[model samples]
Target: MTTTGTSSSDTTATGAARPGGPGQLAGRTVSRVGFGAMQLERLRGDRRGALALLRRAVELGVDHVDTAHFYGNSFVNGLLREALRPEDGVLVVSKVGADPDPGGRIPLRPAQRPEELRASVEDNLKSLGVDQVPVVNLRRLDSGPGLRAEGDQAVDIDDQLAAMTAMRDEGMIGAIGLSSVTAEGLRRAIPAGIVCVQNAYSLVARDDETMVEMCAAEGIAWVPYFPLGGAFPGIPKVTEEPAVLAAAQSLGSTPSQVGLAWLLQHSPNTLLIPGTADPGHLEANIAVGAITLDEATVASLDAVPSRSADVRIG
Candidate 1:
């Protein structure tokens, strides 16, 4: 937390050399299709296996990774530390607003207070073994498909931003990002120089369509979590859609790949951080950039019904 931000004049990275095509995140060029380390918690007991998967991602030209200190109680962060080399220019993005609750069935509890957010940043630095986090997302608990802040946890956005600004100015962090935020929240946070937004969006889940476009217009990255959707209640799975399945068959790709490709083509600023513990799935997720959907297929997928989801990426 003592390191200064990698202050720079280059507003974006020329990421043609990276995977999933290049896009900006935290003011750096990173592959639009990055890796999400949350799923590595399932490999907590298999350190060797986890390390191998992460290494394989780097080999595929992945240059962006999204993680959180509360993920497996910092278990995933530790794996990133061992598997990723800072010299490789991998931009690690971490989110705060929740802490691991090992004793709870859900294993996560909101820690949204301003002071707690600051502490979470330091915890992430220590766990990930980084001098300065390239990007630290302030995951607002104002609304959620997950735990909501209550009582003292319900702090003002200004107060939270104040803490984050102090850290950025002092060089503890490189830039700021937001997650699980609404249109109004993103507007209020604009002056802070937000570099990205992580929301629950996918081909089947288009509730944040406007927000995604806003980010694009503002030169902010739109990092969608649960890009392929999941089994959670209300969060529809993208692979099950009839149009997606048909496109996969015609293009000789998986339904999952079709869903991911659509998101990339949906918005130029959109970044995908699909997580998987399987090596094969990791390769497929990164290879999504090569899958192209013609206008006709894209239109059909876009025509598919959009539904509201109770759960977004936490």
Candidate 2:
């Protein structure tokens, strides 16, 4: 298994400042810096290692985890079911709108239709052995880092929400969130009580700056996906930035830590789900919530400017 930089003792020594800190999310308090389970895809062959990695993250005081039924075609969810315990109190968040493209060239195929999304939720519930999901992010595939909706996959936001609302009413899901959606779509979903929004966002990818602000204004958790960009178009590598590297050197921390710290400091409502199977990296990512950047350093990093690119859905 693995973790970020700070050890459990190191985090405890500065618990107030570290412990990956907690923030409000859908009426529940969860770590501001949580874990994303995508990286576990490769660890499937090593079940023990995968379980330990997930357990290690929880031990580091991570109380939030972003996952999806489509990830590894639900293989990751099986790991979560085995690794996480009820007393852990981890707010396991899942997303719908794509099904695993099993035996296909692509990793995922669009499942944007309302019924498909409902089926994905059912898959999550069964795979995780949970009766009701805490929060389910409806992934609108009008845009992509992965799959995009075309043909029959092009479904309206209102219709997708209708299905989600029905499930929520039946106690099938605790809360609802949006993923890969637009400002206009978010605005329309206000009455639906969206608890969060997930999009490809980071220090360099500021195209969603306005939307982040919008979420903040409305008290919605802006749970950005690729906070430390990974081969996404127009999103630069945070580790490669001179300012980030210099800051990391000065702070005596890794560039990845600084990059993640910037995200925590970027907005009050922001929550992180940077994922990794490597223990050191996991601990480093969680430790980011504790690393505070000085105003000068933050300004320098900010000056790097947002390389806005089109990743939109209306």
Candidate 3:
């Protein structure tokens, strides 16, 4: 791992015009309801279908897209390259740290050594066909088998931040973001000028409530990975809850839509990146920004067992 420790300001394309909907992301105004490309890997060999879905997202005025070169072993980024143009006004946010091995399973490890981090950023650039990534997140593994048992040596947050900061200074990346981070991690990352934090959070998976409020206060974009019951395993499923179902029926909205609506109203800095390879689901996910929930409904939804003790991440 090379540790040159040269940090600089971001040099990505500036002045991205905001699309109609919720406000700014990382100081650049954008649609609050963003699209996540992780689920596209499940499409298998349907690359054409994946491309079409991405294009449809753009057509629907989605200006923010969350992706990673490691997703689908670089397949998702390749699809994004073919589907959308750089001038389309889409702010592509990618991550480095988690990589899918040849077996197609991303074994969690502390691979954020400076040189590896730089190489991962370059890999994202090459796969997405961009000179500088619009936003690159340094994903930290907060919980895993070996990682949980071993502790800090598994992943040094400062070293990883230094590497990303170096890349930003070198004009290889735009803004910097972090994923799967705790409040302490955020505190350590603040000096690095972190623009966002992507963590496993939702109605049921509400372990990161403090982190959410911290991001809101610090003006950092809180990108929740699984707004629904998807992504992280072991967290209590929100969609299957009785209150969620009753509220969905009362509001005449799908459970998924209700969950997303709650998130949109949860915090101003909260950015939704619900993933779906299905075109129909994609439309529904974007439309979630419009569903307004009353205070009574919000209170009732909160009553569901969302405490951290009830949630678990694998």
Candidate 4:
């Protein structure tokens, strides 16, 4: 799994330029099998390990990497800057809105005012060592009883859009996107030229299927946050299902590979940003692109029970 000397020209069975080859991002194209840099923070381990993982991901042909100013006191972006050169074909997308607390707990906060938003974008530019980010998602206020009670105190969607539009016009961000959004939120943002949507989606959390379909129909890229359920770590439940297991057995691949393959086959608009702090795990996740499920296997996987109803909106 160590990618100390690997080049981008290494070919796979599909003969694609790279894993999950260039996908549309706000009309621009980037790799579909993107890397999520959340684990680059010193969340529960050494920061050096996280930095190495970022370098390893780039070496593995993951051209798209997602992060946020809120991740690890913004240290994760710095780590990415240290590992990746700006000229590499990397599309770094970051979100704004939440800030880390003293204890490292992240809580949803009101969107910054127009001037503050501009400053925040500038701060992200400095930390990530980039003049302009490929995509910037306006992390929305988390929906729940407390936020609901806050009511009018929350940043108005119109105001948020106004600020984002200004950023887009200024060329600070190449495209606009939304995270943790609802159908209504999307309806409001779509008119403002949203090109991407990020939400918690996996076999165990399918609540955003409607949004996924909408993005597909609109030709917007839908990047799922947790392709693997957060509740069950390390266990490949989605790929262990009877249908997937059979496919994996036939293909001689792991369950995780089958799961990711199924996801890619399910929707052309789908882009996965699976996160990992380990180089071996990152390589394994990227290699999932080699597994292709047959039509019958895909249909059987579609018939599997969905957790769409159990996902909590908060």
Candidate 5:
């Protein structure tokens, strides 16, 4: 995979764009390198910085931008809308479900009543400042164990599909996606022609390996939300891995870049949405697209020891 684009103003802040991989979403060609908008809130009080990164993303040729109403109280979507022109050929993918309460807590369980799903879609459209979002993922609860525990019945896949189909028919969303889904869950949802699947996958995380392969075989885009791992404290950073460090040193690239390149090479259908608040880091993230790993290097990096499976996301 190779990306083609000149460095933007934020290039120095991070790095340059690498070659990009190929993927099609709703019949539109998209670069596998996507901007994750979770960092927009870090610049909330400093809107200028957030806007700059958003604009820089477009200028850098990032066609896909991921956000969610549940992120930063829906401020991230608004910032995205404010930063880019309406017809700039950017694909905005937002997730619904897990509406946080006033206390800023996402329920351990999901509540996707038909009416609730409808309202969530409407709110997402309004918050995103677009009549139709390129993709809307129905986020499932991060529960453990049994299928019933994951809120499978809370929002039936058929019901969700019906809602998404209605939105697509109404031109409110171009495609539908699913996040945090299990193999069984995805099997149930597959009939909907899910365009994408966002799950926690990285060099250290392979919980979604089967699902990722399934998406690849089906020509559906597989989006790894935490391609570099979660932002929370105590989580292992991809940059800290010995393999990533060595690769970065050999290529004169950053660890983040190496981590992302590893993911791009992991699967043709894989798309990464690594998020960063600093313009420099964002540019560096995009530049990872340029780094290529030789077969030996790819094997060595793939052999790096990962943390225990106990750390896996539910």
Candidate 6:
């Protein structure tokens, strides 16, 4: 399970002063460890608690935030608008191409039509109270229920990239990103240019490892959405697995901390945007940036078996 080319300098922690140690994201220098606004609206109906959490994260030197208009049905972005000032120095990365209904139901269908993309970006600007979003990822539609592997299916992202490229040309977006994509999809979209890729990846889920390598080689930031393995409830839990538990016990760290450290060591280009609603949980997650795993531990964790059929390492 030992990564081949990882070095000590590449494993810098993201503390309040360091903040990922001069890492660059989307051509913008930002913290390698960032915040995700997905669960902010789910904090037991505590809006102020959520706002306080955002401000606290920034105070801890988190300069990058992953969010979307559909997150909490645009509620999270509105909260961000209140928490962040235009000169807060935080890069708010939002997404388009998926429109949650007013009630915020499941199965967010794709809305990548050119007109729909324009409207979606406009909605994000209005909700976040920003003139221009730093980055906008075009999320691809899933072919089925759970995460589909790159080998399972392929999606054409040419049109989607073209639309986003137009927006970038118009100065509406700072950079372009892709989500839920396969290697083939990235290949199709790369000609138009991309700055980042946000995919579902974790210690247990190595499906997108090749994509991670590709991003590394191309100097594109690899932003993994579910680095902690919480996106799919039905999938096997990484923290509960025997290998992770043993490593946590041996290292005197929590399972969540061990999991995140694995991601930071997995690749230098790997940037984490782990999400949480509780302030305590947020602090705990930030501290994960400081945990360093030994090679033996990495091998042990890598040997952990995948219990879900969704394991797509191809």
Count of clashing residue pairs in every prediction? 0, 10, 0, 0, 11, 0
Better of 2 and 6 by TM-score: 2
Model 4: weakest 10-residue lDDT segment is 1-10
Candidate 3 residue lDDT tens string, 1-314: 01111212221122322222655665576778878998998886888899889878877767779998878778888888888875566788998875556553343444556777888898988998878887888877673111231433355788888889889998889889998777898998998899999887788768878888898888999888767764444556778888889889998989999888888888888888888989999888877877889999999998887734233332
TM-score of each: 0.93, 0.92, 0.88, 0.83, 0.85, 0.87
lDDT (Cα, tens digit) per residue for candidate 1, span 1-314? 12222323222132224555667776666677888999999997889999999888877777788899999898999998888865556788899999998998689988988889889999998999987888899999754467777789888888999999999998888889999888899999999999999987888778888898899999999998878876587677999999999999999999999999999999999988989999999998888988888999999999988877556334
Give me the candidate number with maximum lDDT.
1
Q: Candidate 1: which stretches are off by over 4 Å?
A: 1-17, 312-314
Task: Return the clash pairs for model 4, or none.
Answer: none
RMSD of 4: 5.3
lDDT of 2 by residue, 16-121 (tens): 3335565778876666878899999989789999999998887887777889988888899999999987666678899998888777776777888889988999
Ranking by lDDT: 1, 2, 3, 6, 5, 4
Expressed as tens digits, the lDDT of each residue in 1-314 for candidate 4 is 11012223433212335677657776555567878888766443676777667766766777778898767766887787877764455677888755555452224444445555666777788888776777888776543111221444366667877998889898787778987777888988898999898876776457778888999998889887667554334323575577767777888887777777777777899888888777777888888766677778877778877654223322
lDDT tens per residue, model 5, 1-314: 11122222322112333236445665556777878988777787999888888888777768778888767777887897788774456678888765645453332234466566678788888888777777889776542221132444466667777887788788877788988777787888888778898877778767677888899888889898767764454556787888889988998898888989999888988887878898888778878777789998899888976652223222
lDDT of each: 0.84, 0.82, 0.76, 0.70, 0.72, 0.75
lDDT of 4: 0.70
| Clashing residue pairs for model 3 | none
C-alpha RMSD values across all candidates: 3.2, 4.8, 5.7, 5.3, 5.4, 6.3
Candidate with the larger TM-score of 1 and 4: 1
Best-performing candidate as measured by TM-score: 1
TM-score of 6: 0.87
Can you give the lDDT of residue 237 in candidate 3? Answer: 70
